[model samples]
Structures are given as C-alpha cells and as structure tokens.
Target: MWTEVNNSLHRKFEFKDFSEAFAFMTRVAMIAEKMDHHPRWTNVSNGHQMFLQTVACKNSIQFINRVFAHSNQ
Candidate 1:
C-alpha cells in the first residue's frame, strides 16, 4: 500500500532480485512518461522505494497502484 508523507505518496517494493526490481522501475517509467508524471525513487538490491508528489495529479496514485500490483508478475 502507498503511504502519504510530506505531501507525497510513498511506497517501498521488494522484488526477487536486482534485475526484477530494475525491470519494474523501467516499466513504471514508461507509464509515467506517458502521463508526464515521474517518480523519485531509490533502488538497492531487490528493494525499490518510490515517492510521487500529490501535486502531480490524482491519477498518479491510481496509476502507481496498477503498476505495483502487476509488478510481481
């Protein structure tokens, strides 16, 4: 789930490996680019931590969830 903090949405995701985590971030970037909304994040090993400013747009949160939900697949 996404946590709201500092007027932004924050979430940390873990993947099977670094490659998996990197792939997920790549996918998110493509989607975000289409909407002109980008996320700020950190990646370390299998962990991916991301934050999206609420000011971006309401759909950002929804879009993030959709991507996150399917990331495991």
Candidate 2:
C-alpha cells in the first residue's frame, strides 16, 4: 500500500532483482504516460521507491489509489 506524506503519495517496492525492478518501472511508465501523470521515483539496489503527486490537483490521493490498484494487479 501507499502512504501520503507532504502532499505526496509514496510507495516502496522490493523486487527479486534489478531486472525485475526495471521491468516494473517500465510497466508503470507506460500507464503513467497514458494517464498523463508522472511520478517522482528512484531505484536503489533491488528496491524502487515512488512518490506521486498531481500538479493540477496539488496532491495524488485519488490518482495514487487508481494507479496503485492497477499496479497491484
């Protein structure tokens, strides 16, 4: 699940390896681009951390819920 802090929706995910992490990023990037919403993210070792907030809405509470639901599947 993701948490909200400082007006941002944040999530941290651990993968099996670097390859899996990058793959997950690729998948997320595609969906994000289609939604016209982008997230702040980082990859370190086998973990990926993401922070999502909408410039238009000033927060990502709604968008994050939708995105997280899709990503979980």
Candidate 3:
C-alpha cells in the first residue's frame, strides 16, 4: 500500500524476481513518459520503491503512489 510521507507518496512493491520487477518498471516508464510526469524510484532484487508528487493546480499538490502487481510477461 501507498503511504504519504514528507509530502511524497511512497510505496514498496515486491515481485517474484528481478525480471518481473524490471518489467513493472518498464510499464511505469511508459505511463510517466505519456503524462510527462516522472517519479523517483529504486529497485533492488525483487523489490521496488516509488515516490511521487502530483501537481493538481497552481496551489494544490497531491502525492500519489501506484503499485503494479506483476504477471506473466
């Protein structure tokens, strides 16, 4: 699950293996590129940590975290 911490949305996800984790990151990259909004993330072995902050308007900001469940790829 995602948690809001220090004005950032933070989440940790676990995958079956490094391959699955990498595939998940790749998908996220596509979405980020399309939205023109990138996030800070870290991957190690079978785990991934993501941190994001979303700008809603000129004065409003929301932090959000999306966890991707890995499947056969």
lDDT of each: 0.72, 0.77, 0.68
TM-score of each: 0.73, 0.79, 0.74
Write candidate 3's Cα lDDT for 1-73 as tens digits: 6676666666898999999999989988887776666777999999999877654543223422333211111
Query: Taking the tens digit of each residue's C-alpha lDDT, what string does model 2 give over 1-73?
Result: 7777787777789999999999999998888777777778999979989887776775646755466545644
Runs in model 1 with CA error above 4 Å? 54-73
lDDT of 3: 0.68
Show how many residue pairs clash in every candidate, following the order shown: 0, 0, 0
Instruction: Write the candidate numbers in order of decreasing lDDT.
Output: 2, 1, 3
Candidate 3: worst-modelled 10 consecutive residues by lDDT: 64-73
Best prediction by TM-score: 2
Error of 2 at 32 (Å): 0.5
Minimum summed lDDT over a 10-residue window in model 2 is located at 64-73
Alpha-carbon shift of residue 2 in model 2 (angstroms): 0.7
Best prediction by lDDT:
2
The 10-residue segment of model 1 with minimum total lDDT is 64-73
